[model samples]
Target: MASAHHSRKPSGRASLPRRTTKGPLDAVDDPSLASSRHSPLPQPPQDEASGSTAQQSANPQPSIQHAQQPSVQVGEPIKEERELSFLFDTSIYHPLSQLEVPGPFRKPFLPPPTNETSVARSLEQLDALLSQCEFLRAAHLAGSILTSGTVRPTDSKTVFRLLAVRYSCLELSGNLLLAAQEAKALEDLSSAFYYDDPNVDKAEDDEVLQPHRVPHHIMPFSLRLQALRLQSIGFSDPRRGVSTLYDTAFECREHLSTPSTTPEQRVLWTERLHEVSIWVVNALIEMGDLDCAARTLETIKPGNSEHRALWTSRMILVRIKMGDMAKAHKLMKDSEFTPEDKLALESLLAVADGRYKEASEALSKSEAKADPSMTALVKQNLAVAYLYQGEVPKAKSLLEELINDGHSFQTLTINLATIYDLTSDRSRDLKMSMISQIAGLQKDQGQSRAFVNADFKM
Candidate 1:
């Protein structure tokens, strides 16, 4: 009775149609059924006025759109930066053209040789110029030879010869520093050749097929001797200078006696020996070593009239310094000298003998008018005579004249200072000023205190 009542109630509500649910197999077989089950529900048409309101409800903030706009702008710059980076990077690796590529480093260019005979001809020309005393031309020619790059090891002899001659030329031309450098090069070459065949004995016979002989120590020694002499004279150290001169003299003598010395070399050594002996004697005299000077002079036999005169004059001067006026007068009479020289010597002897009037008369009578040096010497001696005679005014006048004439000798300058000390009535300040001037002159002439003292005693 309950089931019949329920069914009668459902029929009374309305004679409703039966609703059917589709199975999976039916849905798969029917596209319309599958589409209807999967599709979204249909919505009612929205008015324009309500569309914005719905969109605003869906997204309440404008931050997302603002953020996205900035990201787009920022991304554009990032892309441009990436492109620029790629351009620079690729350009470094791959140049656009061959001209844009860097070239390899290269050395500086030196000029090529002008001709094969250029060096030889230049050397010959230099020799000719030097023989003619044309040192400037010779210097230029030597420079060309050195710069030519033709000085091979095989041509060392020629190159070394040129170097030696070049050094001499430069030295004579007053290029001391450059000459010293050249001389050092020659010394090095000499040392190298000396050790090249140290064990081998030098051949005695020129007829035999001999090894190349080097002028072992002589060349370097001579160069050093000349250098020492120059330094001594330039720097004013006669004691050391004279000692070195003596040493060089002994060496030259020893070298001359050696059996290895050839006739030509002997001639050169003898000449050098004589020259060094003369220097030794002079240096000894300058240093007040009269005994040594006399001994050294005894060893030096003069070769010519010029040498004889020179040695005799030096001997007379030494004897005069020793207060042996009798021997000085004897030497003056025996030696053949010019009229002016004899007069000068006589005046010196007269001064030593205390004959001031005779010395003054002899100095005044000297006819050395054409020679400025001799005139200056006469004036100096005359001034000395005047000082000895107590004629201070005359002595002062002569000294002042010499000073005005620019007499550069140390003796003259020292004498002037002595006269100033003895004769001047000026204040200490004036005397000091005059002394300073004389001192400056001494310094300019490279005079040492010992030299001045010696000159003063003389």
Candidate 2:
């Protein structure tokens, strides 16, 4: 019984694609590939002609647009070209975070690391190899260190040095994007200036991770994820403070792209890629592009049981949106799911037929009482069920319970406020963004004629 605003459409579960090396990252890294669109040729390269060449001698001048190769022409169809370039393969680890393999996937997809006799020896070997290779090799060496899994809280400097060298290479080559991605991974895997010591004056005056300046290792991946989310929802301009995040994401992609192209490197990159997918889905939903969200899910291959169920459940939401119950059920036939899972899914489908009782009964019979956060989610759904059954008090109780538990960041807040018209308890200093969002949903539901951010009224 979730609130009406948070409820699902009557469509059956969606069937998402499997997780192959060529999945969403391929699409995400280059969005142009996602479409059936085409693009004009790339602008000329800066070094196309040198001083001794006749062409260079005659021209004596490279046009401004040539100087700025990928200029943002107002009406030109650069979208597809940009998209394709964006989705270019990193050739790193084919990430496994999005979909679980049915059987245990213990195989090292990456080139197995050279076995070391001891942790200290592995560190020594990594250090010795450092001065002999390029930045990517250095980054690759860092991966080897991680693959060894012994680079402890103490080896932070070693990891940082490796990434610094790798980023330096990208900077030299004018590939800032890839540099940013690698820098981010370095930051996440090892961050410093944590709020742990005494006599450190950890207040705002001495705060480390400030906006104008950011320690390299932490900025990149988070910003990439944030930018992807913003782009998913069609927000061309994110607010002011997020510029660093944008730069980091753009740079990180470039920094990591070359090194990750090797088969072994792709294997190591999976965990971070999975994280990116989850964030992308969230952003897509906010932008209300359900089908595009489904498109992104195409990368999650369901080659085995665990993977099948995980992806099936995700697609089930899509099918619900698509309103294809038969296909949804068909997708789950071989999934070997439990009776409770089936019931919850069926009840989810029943929401379309306006059968609130059956759906609620199905969910209630399942074991959703174990985890507190999950329990809160179920309660939200139950609230929707109650509302559907025309049981106002029951639904209201569940909604109130959710608010008390403090999950005001989702549709949970938006839907309830829409239904109540006015709630007994009001949020103090509510965000204009959230309020404006609720107002839009209200208008869409034919409940209000007022606009939120824009003044357009229906």
Count backbone overlaps in model 2: 54
In candidate 1, stretches whose alpha carbon ends up further than 4 angstroms from where it belongs are 1-208, 211-215, 218-223, 226-247, 250-267, 282-289, 367-370, 406-409, 425-428, 431-458
How close to the true structure is residue 189 of candidate 2, measured as C-alpha lDDT?
20
Error of 2 at 447 (Å): 35
Each prediction's TM-score versus the true structure: 0.45, 0.38
- lDDT by residue (391-420, candidate 1, tens digit) is 888987897787666564545656766776
Reference-based TM-score, model 1: 0.45
- Give the per-residue lDDT of model 2 (tens digit) for 1-458: 11233223212223222212432234335332222111121221122111111112111111112111222211111111111111112332122210221111111222324554455665455444343222233334445544454444234334433334334433322334544443332112221321111213346754444222212232233333432322322334322213322333333233234332333323223334443444444345434666766666555443445445545655665666667677666765655655545665666766756778886776576426325535555566667776778877677677656655444423466446544543333432233334555445544554422112111110
Top TM-score prediction, candidate number: 1
* C-alpha positional error of residue 13 in candidate 2 after TM-score superposition, expressed in Å: 46
Candidate No. with top lDDT: 1
